[model samples]
Target: MAMSDVLDEGPFFHGTIADLRVGDFLAPGYRSNYRPEVVMNHIYFTALVDGAGLAAEIAAELAGGDAIPRVYAVEPTGPFENDPNVTDKKFPGNPTRSYRSSAPLKIVGEVKDWTRLTPEALEMWRERLATLQSDRRAEIIN
Candidate 1:
């Protein structure tokens, strides 16, 4: 499947069912109840842009992880705060972008298993991240 088929905009979100559902995509904000270690608005979604990485993330957050994790096909409606693609820890927590959806995000579907990413998928993900990073840099430069 094409990355555009699964992704609506710049990138998709890889997170637990509860967090995604609870977080308001319409007015995306920080989670008050997140783990103490996590910053107030440092929401870490995936830049994986594929099922394999998404499923792995979902399983990691859940107990047992027997059931499939939900994948949120979200668009980066606003400017992203952190750079998950960046190796440097600009912030104390995991590198993630804090985004507010410009439009309503849709629940694309669930990843049933830890699917393996095809070579094409991996390449697409890398390219997409590069584009996003470049866009962010442009935004800063402007």
Candidate 2:
């Protein structure tokens, strides 16, 4: 795939209102862009392309009354790559680009902020991130 295709064929990241411990791999639900259930909860493994989108989702949930919306980094399993229904789009209420992976993704880790990354988690995230095509590496490096 071309660089743009990699950028677009994302196991794109998304932030949501859920409580999960680091290393937990539970399937989570996120809003979908499709019609009928315009604001439906889709249970799929997912992640943002970068940290900004995750932070934005946490902020929105906090503003909407969720006390502690934790951020988890999602890495898509290989099966999701070829799925035709997967999508990446900007949705209402969310502050950044959001995505929906129709297949289960692994929840590699969680963090209160980018600066709080544990060494182990950071290393693991580096591996997971290597699978994406984002231009936001500096966000995690700092």
**Which candidate's lDDT is highest?**
2
For each candidate, give its TM-score against the true structure: 0.37, 0.41
What tens-digit string does per-residue lDDT give for candidate 2 at 21-139? 55555343443312212333333323344453344343443345544445566665543331123322223333333333334656666644543345575466555544432434322
| Model 2 quality (TM-score) | 0.41
Q: Write the per-residue lDDT of candidate 1 for residues 12-122, one digit (tens) a residue.
A: 654444445434452334332222222243334455544325433334433334543455544444344333323233444433433322234444544444454566764
Instruction: Write down the worst ten-residue block by lDDT for model 2.
Output: 81-90
Misplaced by over 4 Å in model 2 are 1-4, 8-13, 26-63, 81-99, 114-142
* Clashes per candidate, residues 3 or more apart or on different chains: 1, 7
Give the poorly placed runs of model 1, Cα more than 4 Å off: 1-9, 19-39, 51-68, 82-86, 90-142
Q: After superposition, how far is residue 65 of candidate 2 from its true place, in Å?
A: 2.7
